[model samples]
Structure formats: C-alpha cells, structure tokens
Target chain A: MKGISHFLAGVAAATFVPGVVESAAQGSYLIVLGGFFGLLPDTLDFKFARYFEHHINIDPDPANLDPQIIANAVAVEIDRAAETQRAVRVQLHNIPLGPNRWRQYRIRFDAERNEVVITIGPIVNAALAPLDESGQRVARAKTKAKIDYTYDGEMTADIWNGPSFAFVPKAHGVEVQFLPWHRAWSHSFTLAALLGLITGVLFGSLQAGLVAFLGMSAHVVEDQLGYLGSNLFWPITKGRSAGARLLHSGDAIPNFLAVWTALALILFNLDRFSAPVQNRDPLLTPWVYLGTTLIMPALILIGVYAWERRKDHVRREVAQQADIVAELKETEV
Target chain B: MLSVIPSIYLAAPDETSAFIVLPGQKWLLERRGYEAAILTGIGSLCGVIVLVLLSPFLTEVARTLRIILSPHFGWILATVTLFMLMSEWPKGGDRGPTNWARFRAAWSQLAAGLLTFFLSGLLGLILMYRSFAPVPVAFVNLLPAFIGLFAIPMVLTNLIMGTRVPLQHVGGSIDVSPALLLRGTFAGSLGGLFAAFFPVVTGGIGSFLAGHATAQRDERTFIISQGTSKLVYYAGGLLLFFLPGLQLARGGLASMVSTIYTPGTPQLYYTAVAALAVSGAVSFLLLIPYARFSVRFLARLDYRTVNLGTLIVIVALLLLTTGLSGLLIAIPATAIGLIPSFYGTRRMNCLGVLLLPITLNMAGVGPDIARLLGLA
Candidate 1:
C-alpha cells in the first residue's frame, strides 16, 4: 500500500469509533494524532533507516579493462565464489568523453545464460557543450554500445544466494555492491510498540500511546496484504513474513479504494461531530453510509479488478503469439 | 470571471488535470478527440442542469445548517481547508536521480511546506486579531497562493524535469456514440450534483468518485465525465448563490459576491444562470485557441526562463494584493506547500495545519493551545 492508503486506514480505524469523534469535539484530537502516527513507520524506514544500510562492494579483476571482458570474467568469478562461500567483486570505469563530460554504464547479470551484459546509457554534461567540427551540438548526442559475455563456472546453483549489485562511480572505477536487506527491525511490531509507549509517556496519556500502537499495527497489517511483508516479530524473528500475495503496492484500484473509503468515513465522522445540537438526524442514513463507504467501493473494486484481469489476458495472448512467431523465424533461420 | 481565471490556470496546466483524468482517458483524448469532446460536453450540460434543479433544496439545507452551525463554522471550514491543502502535497518517488539530487529536492519541498504552514498560521492569527475594513478580496491572497504552489511549480518542473514535447495530432470534431455520451453525462452529472449539494465537496472529488463508481470502461467516457464534473462544480456551484428562495453563498466566488451585492430574487437567479451559460460558451470557444497557442509557445521557449518570469509575476502579485504582511504569511505557506512532494506523501496532509488547529478550536481546546504557543 502507498503512504496515503496506510495513513487513511489508520484514520479510518480511529474514526470508526464514534467516541473518538465526540472526544474531538471536546478538545482532544487524538484521532488526527493517530493518523499522523500511522504514517510514521514508512517515514522512519524510507527517510532514516535506508541511509544507514551498508552497500556491498564487488570489485572486478584488474586485468580485465574493457567492461565486456570484465563482465564475462566477473560472471565466472561470481559462480566460483558462490560455490566456495566467498564474496566476488567487480569494478567498471566510467567512459570519459571530455573534460567533464562522460558516459555512465550499468551492468546486468543474466542468470539463465550464466552471463553478464553491459549497456551504455545517457550522456552527462557538467557544463556547456563543446562545439563539434561541424559547429553543431555535441553534448546531446546519443551513445550506442552493448556488450555480452558468457560464464561457464561450476557454482551456478548458489549464484541466486549472492548479493544484488548497484554500480557507483569512484575515483578509480565504478563499484558494484549489493544493497542491504530492507523491512527488517525498522518494520517490526516490537519497534512500533516501543515507539508508541515512548510517545504516550511523553504525552502523559495511555490512550494516546494506544492510539499510536494501533496506528502502527494497522500500517504493518496493511503492508502484509501486499508482496513485501514486514518483519512482524522483529528481533524474535530474523526474516520477513511472506505476505498474502493478493495485490501489489502499485495496484491502482486497491489503493484508490483504500483512500476513497477512508476519506468517506472521515467525512461521515466529521459530519457527525459538527452537526447541530437540535438536528440529530444524520445527513446519511446507516444504509446510505454503508452503500457509499462499503458496498459501492467494493463493487467498483471488483469492476476494476475484472477489467485489469481482462487486459492482462489479452496482453498475454498477444505476447504468446509474438513469441511463437519469433520462434518460427528462428527455426527458419 | 474571478473564479474563471484561477480555475482555468489550474485546469489548463496538464499536471493537475493528469490527476483528474485517468490514464486510459488521456490515451482516448489523443486518439479519439471528437468522441471525448462530445462525451465531455454532454456530461457538463447534464451537470449544469442537475445543479439548477437541486439548488432550491440544497440551499435550504445549507441555510438551516449555516444558522445552526454558525458558531463553529469558521473552525470547521478552517480545518477542512487545511486537510484539502494537505491532500495536494506531492511525494518524492524512490526511483530517479542520485541521493544528492533527491536530497536537494526533498529539502526544497520541506522549505515550501514550512513556508505554507507559517503563512497560514499568520493569516489565522490576523483573522483572530482584527477584521480589516476594506478587506482584501478572497482570491487576492488565494490566487497568488495557487500560482506559487500549483502553477509556478508545474511550469518549472515541466521546464526543468521534462523532455521535449512530442508531436501529436490535435484537430478533431465531436462524434461520440449516443450510448457513451449518455453514460458519461449521467455519471458526470451525478458527481456534479453531489458536489453542488454537499459542503466542502469539490468537483475534483465528485468526479473521482463518479469515475470509480461508474467503472468507466473507456478513456473517452472518463474524460467526458471529468469535463462535465468540473463545469458543474465551478459554474453550477456559483449558480446556487443566485437561487430565489435560498440565496446562500457556498464557495469563495459566491461569498465575495454576497459581500458586494445581495441576491434574493428569482429574476436574479434566472439572469445569473443565463450569464453563466453565455460566459461558459464563450470560455469554451476561447479555450481551444488559448490551449493551442500555449502548446506552440511552450514548445519553443526555454522552460527555465518561463519559470523564472512566472516566479517574479507571482511575487509581484502577492505583494500588490496583500502587501508585506501577506508576503510574510506566504513565505511559510510556500514551505508547507512543498512538503507533500518531498516526503512522497499526499499533499493533502498539509491540510492538517488548518484541520488540526481549527478542529481543536471548535472542540474548545484551540485557544488554550494557541495561548501555550503564545499566538493567542
């Protein structure tokens, strides 16, 4: 779920309780505070924890100067290192064009072919373009380069267990390193409880603390609905809990429904609190509210889900036809 | 005319409209422009009709509620407005750019959010302090805020961050199918009616709900619906103020009108409706030429230069309308406004500044907190 969806879920949970709305009218805006706390877990992970994680470096063999040659040699080295339970590294140099202009490249490891491929991307200019011989623009010109290398190492089985890589430019060369594990202690339930407790203590209210706890818990649970589950037990459990793969964070319909429902409920709660004393009649009757807040959203969700599924089906059919055509062409060749 | 200018600017910028129109609808606009336009026209016409029909009942409800809720009305309005602002906050995505670049972007966003927050707080304090006679018009401050927060940023971003505009086919006539036109109109009018009748509800929200509820299968229908919804939300909302037995002001434009000219007659209501129709038609005709000119102009010009010029114009306007004090308030408001984009959260959260303070006041704790902060 996106941040808005999670925030709204926490808000919806708080607003579901009529007491919270009533209390809001009486000078306690704990529900709003709860909504803020709901956004805290993700905020902490992305803004703070991400920076602290160490990058794993993979340095390529110094003998292989060309990226293509280095990629091939590194692939073989990785396989051997994985089998020996040792780390392998790679080093790629930035392709310099001028005083400050250069071409940066990225490396991708192809697991199926047991190979590595290098592709040069966009040009970066530190300053103004130097005129070419034709007196035309030179800085914006495209660079086209692609290289592939195969590996025939004995340790193909354990390559999957090895760390992922990100290429960063250093003075000597580009360093490829694995990014550290995310959604660990930062996403744990234990941390949420501790944070809530501390917050409550600071505010001098147990209820406030409990609201924080609930908000954080709601966020964790919502995340669990997606593919990237959080480390629920935290220190007690070292790994993430594999989530129910019903949807992804980027699924538009689910995200929309979550935000829409939350907002509607919040509005209903606000209307309840702000209504005049003499007119006790609710603006929306129970049935209407249910229809708008629950049933209607549910129906829309289903419609979107079905539409996406149909689109996926059509796309897959077309892709399969293309694959078949390509295979036939290969056979003919 | 007052609402039209800002509304057009807000709507004209593709960025905000991108949020309103679904992805599929944009594709439809590019491919089947005629169908899209027809659907939009039908939807808008239906929305206007619905607003006209519902004005009497909605006005009565609004009037009754206004009398009953008058004491805490300001607080409620302030709270909701804050929330609305927060919802508009932009988010920084995990992808694209290096850490340093991302950090700079985040810092700028934070600065903008903080500026908006403090400025809004200052405005609240001023309202609390004394009502200025010959008060600045409602949009005097709001227009600059919109331009600074929404317009300038969009223009700057498109200039700095965007790629060259690709050549696209633009000429087309309305040739929508009857079924699509009806469905689009019905859905749009329904949403527009909800916005027209409801408090704190805008056309954007209404159209969003309608789009989802109808599960519009095509981009053409969705685009049409959004078009109708916006018309109803803006023009229809204003028309409510002219209603005979229920001459109640609903939006900023209506409130300003009420401040200047009293509305009480059925004749005035009919006249206003006629005027709305005439202005809307004229605006629609003008939109085509203006949009075409803007596209051509923007494609050739350097975005950075345009952005710089826009920034200067906005600042000048802000100073002229609100003076030094308004500029001071705007500084903080701008910072707060920038937060949503930096944090990768919905800008709507900025609304918290108003919602939190005003809601607290309504609940009777606001004054105490203000005193604690020494604002009181």
Candidate 2:
C-alpha cells in the first residue's frame, strides 16, 4: 500500500512475463517500465493532481494562531455540505512561524460528538523538532450535521504541508474524504489499458504494453487490500469501492512483506529465467528458498501484526466509549 | 561508503568515511556521545561476524550476478539515474507573483539538480580526456576534483555561515532492541550488497532502494540500517577486489589499489575476509577515542577557523599532488558542487560526474558524445 510496495510490485509483475527477465539480462530496459508505471498512479495523484485541485483554503495565520476560529471554520463546512448537499472541499495549510519553522496544530472531526476538535501543537523546526519555546492548547466547535471524517488519529499540520478534506453529503451524513484529489481518475484500469496500448505501439513490442498494464493494475490491486481502495473502475464508477481492510496502508509489517516478497520473486526470476539452463545456476532454489525467505518470516510477522492490531482495536473501542478524542502526543528527547 | 541516511549526506563527502556516525552524530553527540561509541564498538564486533558468515555465500552470488548483469549495466545505471532525477520535487516557490513564476520557482530545485549532474558529467568528460594533470600524478588525478565537488563546498558553507560546534554530553547507556538491530542489519546488507555488486550503483542509491524495500518510517531504524549499510558497501566493494573470479574495481580505494596490484585466488579471498572482520573490529575500537577526542577537541575550536584551515590544507594538497592543473579542475568542480546548496537541489546529482561518463562508455556512446562536443 506504500509507494515503494506499489513500485516494487510493478517490477515484480514484469518478471512474471516470459522473456522479460532474459531481456533484462540481455541489457534491455523493458523492466524499468514496470517500476515506472507501477509508481505512476500515485505520482500523478500526489505530484500533479493535488496541486490542481479546487479547494477552499484554510490558511492558518501564525500571527494570531487561534484554534477556536479554525475549529468553527471546519464545522461550518461539514454542516454546509450536509444541509446544502454540495460537496465542500477544504485544504488546511501549515502556519509558517519563521524560516524553516512552523506553528504545528491538529484538527480532528469527532463523528460521535458531531464536533470538530482543534489543538494548537508546538512550533516545530524543519526536522519536526519542537522548539520548546511554544506551548500546546485545545479547542472544540459543534456542528449541526454528523461529522463523518474518518481517521484513527488527528491530522497534524506540521513541517512540510497540511492535510485536505472533502465533506460530501451521503445518505447517512456528510462523508469526509481525506485528500479528495487522490485515487480518482489516475488509478483507473481504463487508463492503464489505454496507456499500455499506446506504449506497445510506440515501442513496437506487445510485451512492453502488457508490462505497463500489469504494473499499474498491480498497484490498484494492492491498494484494494488496504483500508481505502482506489478508484479502480474510474470513469465507469465515480468513487472508490470498499476495501477488504486486510491491512492499513501505513502499517509496517504488511509493507515489509510486500517489499521482501517482491525482492524474492525478482531474485528467483533473475536466476531461473534470465539465461539458458547450461549457464544458469539458481541461487534462490524453489520451495526451500521460498519457505525460508518468504514463508517463515511472513508468517511470523503477519501473526505479530494481527495480534497488535487486535489489541489496538480493543483500546480504540474503550477510547471511543469514553468520548475522549485522542491526540498524537509529541515525544521529548 | 555512500548513503543518504544513517549519516553520510551528499555534498558532504566527509560522511563517506563516517557515514554510519554522521546521520545520528548530531543527536548522539548532543545527548549521549559515550553510549553511541560503546554500542558501535559492539556493533563492529557483530559486523565482523556477519561479514565472515556472509562471505562464502556472497562470493558465489556475486560471481553469478556479475556474469548475468555485466552486459545490462547500462540500463541498470540508466534506471537509477532516472529514478533519482524523477523522484525530486519542488522544495520552494509556494508563493510567487504569478502562476508561471511560482511554477518556475518550484521547478528551480529540479533544474538545479539537473544542471549539477550535467555540469559534473561535463567536468568528468573533460578530465577523462584532457592531460591537465601531469602524467606522473595521473593515477590520483581525480583527487582534487573529488575534494572540490564533495568536500570543499561543505567546508565553505560552514565557514560562510559562521557555524559553531556545541559541547557534547557523554551518557552511559543506549536504549534499543534486538528486533530493531536485526531489521537494520537486514535492510542495510540488502542495500550494501546491491550497491557493492552493481558496477556503477553507489551505496547511496543502494540504500535508497533498500529503504524503500524495507518501508522503514522510524528514525532509529534509519540510523541503524545506514550504519550496517556502510559496513557492507565499503567492505563488500573491497571484497570484490580479491574475489577469485570477479576482481572488479569499485569505489575510490579499490580503484586506486587496483592500479598497483591484481588479486585472484580463493585462499587469498578468504584471508581478505578474515582481515576485514579483524580490521573492522579494530577500527571500531579506535573509533570510540577518535569520536570522543573530536567532541572534546571541536568544542574548543571555532567552526569557521576549522573550515578555513581545512580549505587551505585541501588546496595545498591538491596543488602539491597534481600541480596547478588540479586546481584548474577543482575550480569548476567546486563551483558545480556549490550548485546543490545554493539552489536547494540534491547533492546526489554530483555523482553524475562518474555516473554519466561511465554509463555513456558502457552504452558504447561516450566517444560519439565526446566527438560531438569536440572533446574526443
């Protein structure tokens, strides 16, 4: 679900096709296309799409640094979207305190309470190291409609940039979509196929086209396994489909599994299929290698992750019942 | 050793020798300098064990991979080049007069990076063909250029900014876990071996790839992995020098060593591995005092004065080593190296000096390109 996982998955997908590995051994760059296309969807969304989005900007003022005002502004948008039925898109920008310094803050929409919680966090340097000069405080504002913002923790506006949210009116209430510009038309199967066709024609090789198509689709499929699926169908269906929720996108174990599994597959393919039988001697032997590198490690890590997630779920349930909105605590060195 | 994290930043070539220490050095020195020294000492002992154990297996894999990937070096190099160049984004220009102005300002960082790469590449090409440096000193010809590109700019920056070195605290213990260590070693080795084996792929690139493969978000993991990566990349690259079948030169030291000696034997290779393990432990032992000494000594000195003295020594050495001609090369290289800091671009682009020329040669078009530019 991480960018690297998607990219590596694409490269691994290319190795599956016959002749691709051998061609790589023969000095062909067709394999690079796999990684390029694999990372393309996310690249499109983050690098280009996010910049072009039309959103109501909530540019915080470092001079005043008011949390109550910011909280009410967010509540008004969620309420307006619920009552008006027109999706309201908002972008919260970080407040710059000085050169390479920012006034950090947090904004979380509590669904159960129908309130937007705002917390003024510490002023942090470029490295997200709090300057120790500023103190933190909290504020809250009520909304008329049910707050449908979904996230496990508060969105911290620090260092690089801030987060965005789209309050779209659903049957239940206004659903808050984080980074509304992401995973839309860019993650489409339709676009992948079209691009594959064009690439094939341009390269005069069907294999290149297939690799391109498979690489991008691999990303879409991987995302489907996470909490938030991409807009796979894209033009055919306007919104993302519900994901399997097998894992969180930011979870470390699943990401490591994906990366290591891809590496194993690549090494195996490189040794097994890259050359003739007489010359080739495989380093990554069949089942034995897979059992050791892929199977055993993956089994142990996944079991641990499952255990941890269950514990986290129980803690979350307790926290939710208490009606306490949790904020990400800063660590002191 | 080359790396982006766990110390060893680009444009600050000083990190290469102490890449493992540099990344965490600031924090460690500021808080618990003594603990870092002790742990790294033990880490060296562990490194020796890891290297000795991995030697036999790594040698065989290296031999085979070389045979398979030798011809494909061009594309592999190109892939790394493309990935690095494309991955960079706008660091500034969030506010400007017009849309186009902001767009251009944002793109300036990328442009600066590209300009640095191409310019360094041009410098590499010029140095490769021209006899600016005397033939007697030709073996160490690029020394001045390297110092200019990687080392001098950092010193200059420190001198210009009137930087200060703060007093360090020496703590007794460091808090860490076995799992963290294992993860760091695993990730570091993967990256180091990848860089060590690849013809032109630097350790920085290898570590970058490995970092992505591991998906490590934790700061401690980053520090530990890069520490391991330096050991593997530097030692592994050198190990290739004595490999029975695959005696290829890489990195500055190995390439220089290759000029005087040629090694090819299984027994000798094993001996080198043993020596590496032993020397690694010894060096780590020496590191504690040296690191402690630096903290103590630097605290009393002015950063500007130190940087100024280093600049003088570097220039004097360059002049003495290759005469005035090396200075000729260093001038342009230093100017080119300064681009990254001034324009807020990537220092890794400075690697283009070696990467471009080498990639072009492997692709069999270096001559053609040089001819076009009248350098051939």
Candidate 3:
C-alpha cells in the first residue's frame, strides 16, 4: 500500500513535471494546479474528519490518548497572615508577551506530603546543553508539568487551547497558519502520520496510513508555500516567521495555459517523439509534450509490474509454507 | 446532394439505424468550445514536426517561428495525411512493399526499376487528377520518402522467400499465394496512407449519420409508442438530419464553398442547404413505413446512440460503394471493373480510422510543415 502511494506519486510527478515544464514560460499556476490535484483526496477526507469531530461530536478529542487528568498542584512561598488577610501562599497569573500574544505563567503549590518532592529547572538553560541532552530537557519539563497540572482545569484549558494545534499528538508550541515558518514539521506531519498509522492498524492494512500521510503532508506543504510562514521545525525552534516564500499568488494564468498545452500534446502524440523545443526549435515543443504523455503511462506500468511481483512473492511464500506443513504431517504419520 | 446529376444515385441500406455511436466522437464533439483547443494541440504537435525539419531551409528565425505557428502546421499535416489516404484503393491480399515488388517484377523486362518509378509517378498523376490536383501531388511527394523509410526492408524480406506469397490457411494447413501476397501488400500501403490522412472521411460521415439516427430513435422512444403512425418514423429521421445539417451549415454557403479548394461564389452554402432539404423530404417519404417496421423488427435489440451509429455507418458505406459501382457500369465499364472497384473501395474503408486525429489537428492552422511540402 505504501508502495502504491509512492508509485502514484511517481506517476503524478512524471506526468505533471513535464506538463509543467512544457508550459514553463507560461508560469507556476499550472504546477500549482497539479499540486492541488495531488492534495484533492486528502482535503476531502480532512473535511470529513472535521465534520465528524465538530458536528457529530463523535470522539471530539483528536489526541484520544489520555482522557482524564491525573494530577494538579500549585506552589507556595508565603508566611501565615491573620484576620482579614488570608495566608498568602502563591499567586498565578498569565503574562502576555509574543507575536502570537502567548502568555507565560508561574505558580507554586504547597505539598501535603514531602514524599512528593518538587523540582524546578532553568527555562532557557536547555539551549546550552549537548544535542543528546536536549530531548532530556524537554521531556523532563513536560513530565513535570504533566504531573503538576494533569488533574486540574488549567491543564485541560491549556491542552484544548494552547498554541499547539493538531488532531493528533504534536509537540508543544506548534501552531497552524496559512504560511508556516518551515515545512511539514510543527503540527501537520506528525498528526497526519499518527492518525494514518492508527487507522491502518484498525483497518488491518496500510492504505489508511498512506492516505493520511499524503493528505496531511500535502496540506502542510501547500501552506508552507504561502506568503506567511509555518512552524516547520517545531521542536527545534520556538520561532515563527510570516514569509519563507516558496510560492506566491501571481502565477495563475500561465499555469492554466501550460496545462492546456500538456493535455493537447498527450492526446495528439501518444507515441511519436515530440520536437525538442528547448534543444532545437524553440517553437516546436515536442519533447516537453512527449515527456508529459509518457510519464504517467510508464509509471503506471512500473507500479503494476511491482505489484505483480509482490503478489507472486506472497504466493510463493504461501506455497512453501503449505509444503512444509505437508512434510510435517507425513513425518507425524 | 449528388442526386442532382440523376445518374449519381445512392443505394439505400436494407435497414437504417435509429441510433449511432462514433469512435472518439463523444470526446471530441461534447467538449464544449474546448474541443477546438484540443484539436489545436494535436494539430500543433504534427505541424511542429514538419516545421522543425524544414526550418533549416527557411529563415534563421524559422525555429522560433515554428512554435508560434504550430496550430496551422498541424492542420496542414492533417489535411495532407487525409489526401494521401483517399488516393489509394486498398487490395485485400497486397501490403505496400510486397505488392510493389510484384508490380515491379511484372514490368521488369521492359525497363526494370526505371519503369517502376515511372509507372508509380504516372499512377500518382492519375490519382492527383481524379481526386482534384494538389492532393495527389502531395501524396506523390510523400511517396518516395515513405518507400525509402519503410518499404525497402519489407520488399527485401519478401524477395528472399522465393515466392512473394502471403500467409493463408487452407484445408487445415498453412500456405501462401502470390495473389494473396500482392493483395496484402497493396492494402497495407494504401491503407496506411489512408489511415494517416482521413480517418473521419472514410467512416466518419457514415458514423455521424448512424449516430444521429440513434439519437433520434432514443428521443422517439420517449415521445411515442410503437403503435403510433408510421409517418412518425420518417418525421424523426427528417428532424434528425435537418437539425444537424442546419447546425453544421449555419455559417452557410461560405462553409460549403470552402470545401471546394478552388474558390467560386459565396452561394455554395445555399446550394448545399437546398440540396439537403430535397433529400430530407425524399428520405422522409420513403422511410415512413420502413421506420414503423423497424420498431417491431428491432424490438429485441438495444438501440443506444453508439450501437445505432455503428450499424448505420457500416450499412451506409456498403450501400454507397455498391451504388458507385452501379454508376460506373452505365457507360462502358466491364463486370471485372465494377466488381473489383467495389471490393477495392470497401477494403479501402479500413483506413478510415486514421482521419479525425490527423484533420482536427490541422484546423485553425497556425504553423505547419505541410506548407513547405506545398501540401497545406
């Protein structure tokens, strides 16, 4: 199934790349159309998923990991007060700061038992560590937070409403945007892959995994090409920018014309070699059309061949297993 | 339209299709205005090839000029290809190279290869004059080129076998015959040329008629019951023909005149329309009763547009060819000529599949290599 996806992708690339190149002077819109076509299936599925969660409310929480909070706590640094003033143990407040208007908070809770010890580490100090220790630092921080806030409202609020936005588990601080800082990182890839894997497991096949991964990845990639940026390297960088500029909005016309040209070439010259426009006659764009037409058919054939081979291999294995079982039965007799 | 000559009579098929389906017709015709775009693309591709090959002899900027003018080039290729196809009569046993060898051998003692070339050129001229002038010339120009490229190997292979016999099955045993070999060779060469040029012309017109009949039949089935008056059938046929012809001829006499190659008056469109009107009225009169019988006879058959179109086209072509043979005999032709001509035309129709792709590609001609060949 994974092989199938790779094969389809190859076919698409083969057919579409030549088609785009043939119409290259026309512009990027044609390529964009190809990209959109690639992502069409997943986009439809994403809508379905959205409807299921928001409308039907069947399993609204996408994480589907830990449903109940396990622990909640607040720290204290107060002396006893009398009368009108209660004991001032701790204060909790959200401090607003960044471009996302993200607010940070710090609070301490009094412990009833010394058995449950408290530990606090430096926030920015993890950046100074060796690469191996970096994971440990983040893990340690998250684990502590999980233990402290799991049982309470603040933890639920943060879980449901943080900068992190994903249908499945994603690293903290990742956000969804039309333009992401990087590509395929942050929230998109992880959630898509995880969901797909889960779906495949439940379905007893890998098709779901392929679909999930392709759809999610395409979505992220599409956004990454936008004017604003995406958080492509979520775990690595706590930064986001508006423009990483892989594509822009001005390339619509040329793309359309190019596609039309490609379709024409495909229909007309199913077999004959097209004139190589770039190499010889610039006016005669045979090679481009030829390449475009051949790519899909060739890739499809390759995919079919590989699939047949796999099927044969499976058949052989089954036959061999049957033969071994027969021998064992004969020996037993 | 040919009926005005009175001597130019057409044979009616035993049964006409109430419906039709043409190969590739649905894809081409139903594509909105974009059908032209697709046609242009195919045309450009073919045209561009010729342009590039001939660019060296033209201007330095010929290469650049070719791309911009590719559509026109495509049209030229399509048109020339069509002409090449129609010039030959396909023989059942002869394939091109193999047949050419026998032709050469039959005249070998006279002048050897010189006679063969001379005869070929003469045949080319005859074909040119009969079909209109320029078309045959273009066919001849392509003749030497095609022979050099493809026929030489085939001829050599045929010669080594001692007898230029083709594969034939007889009495449960495989055998070859000289006559069969010649027939195959002739058919192959001519068929290839025809297929390369006018796919639609050979079968398309017939197919279109059949298809129109089928569409009408389907529409009729919805509108009335089989128990209805027989006149309904004729009416349906008339309606079908008139609408399509009118739609096709809306540009009028200008369109009809354009097909003449040598331009005359602008009234040719009116002539065609008028001719069509007369034909429709006559066909309607003849077909009314038959249409009623067809419903009962064809009750068991499913008459979709495609099925009707196919049946109609085959029947129409068969009748047309037969009628042509009949007309050829009126003056001085022998029985041998009539029978052979009928068979040849029927066999030649096998080449009809090649036309539409070639022709549509040539429409709206922007740039084409056929122009250099003087075929465009």
Measured with DockQ on alpha carbons, how good is candidate 3? 0.01
Give per-residue lDDT, candidate 2, residue A35: 85
Global CA lDDT computed for model 3: 0.26
lDDT of 2: 0.71
A1-333, model 2: which lDDT tens digit per residue?
A: 666677778888988978888877766778889888888887776556656666677877777778988998888988889889999999787788765567889988788998899999987655455676556888899999986655657778875457778899998888877667767888889889988999999999999999999999888888777656667887989886666667766566777788889877877777788657327565556898789878998999899889877855533222321111110010001
How do the residues A55-114 of candidate 3 rate in per-residue lDDT, one tens digit apiece?
101111222211221112221111111121332222121211221121222122212221
Expressed as tens digits, the lDDT of each residue in A1-333 for candidate 1 is 655566667766665554565555444567775666666676665444443333322432223324455455455455444444443333233444543343444555443443455543444332112222221111111111111112112111010112233333333322233322345676778987998899789988776677777777777877776555668988999655666555554454665667667767666665666454434555656578778667887897768676765645323222322222221111110
Model 3 scores a TM of 0.20
Superpose all Cα atoms of candidate 3 onto the true structure and report the RMSD in Å to 1 decimal: 30.5
For DockQ, the strongest prediction is: 2
Q: How close is candidate 2 to the true structure, as a TM-score?
A: 0.88
Which whole-number lDDT from 0 to 100 does residue A15 have in model 3? Answer: 30
Better model by DockQ: candidate 1 vs candidate 2: 2
Q: Candidate 3 chain A: worst 10 consecutive residues by lDDT?
A: A151-160
Report per-prediction Cα RMSD to one decimal.
11.0, 4.9, 30.5
Candidate 1 - CAPRI tier? Answer: incorrect
What DockQ do the predictions score, one after another? 0.05, 0.30, 0.01
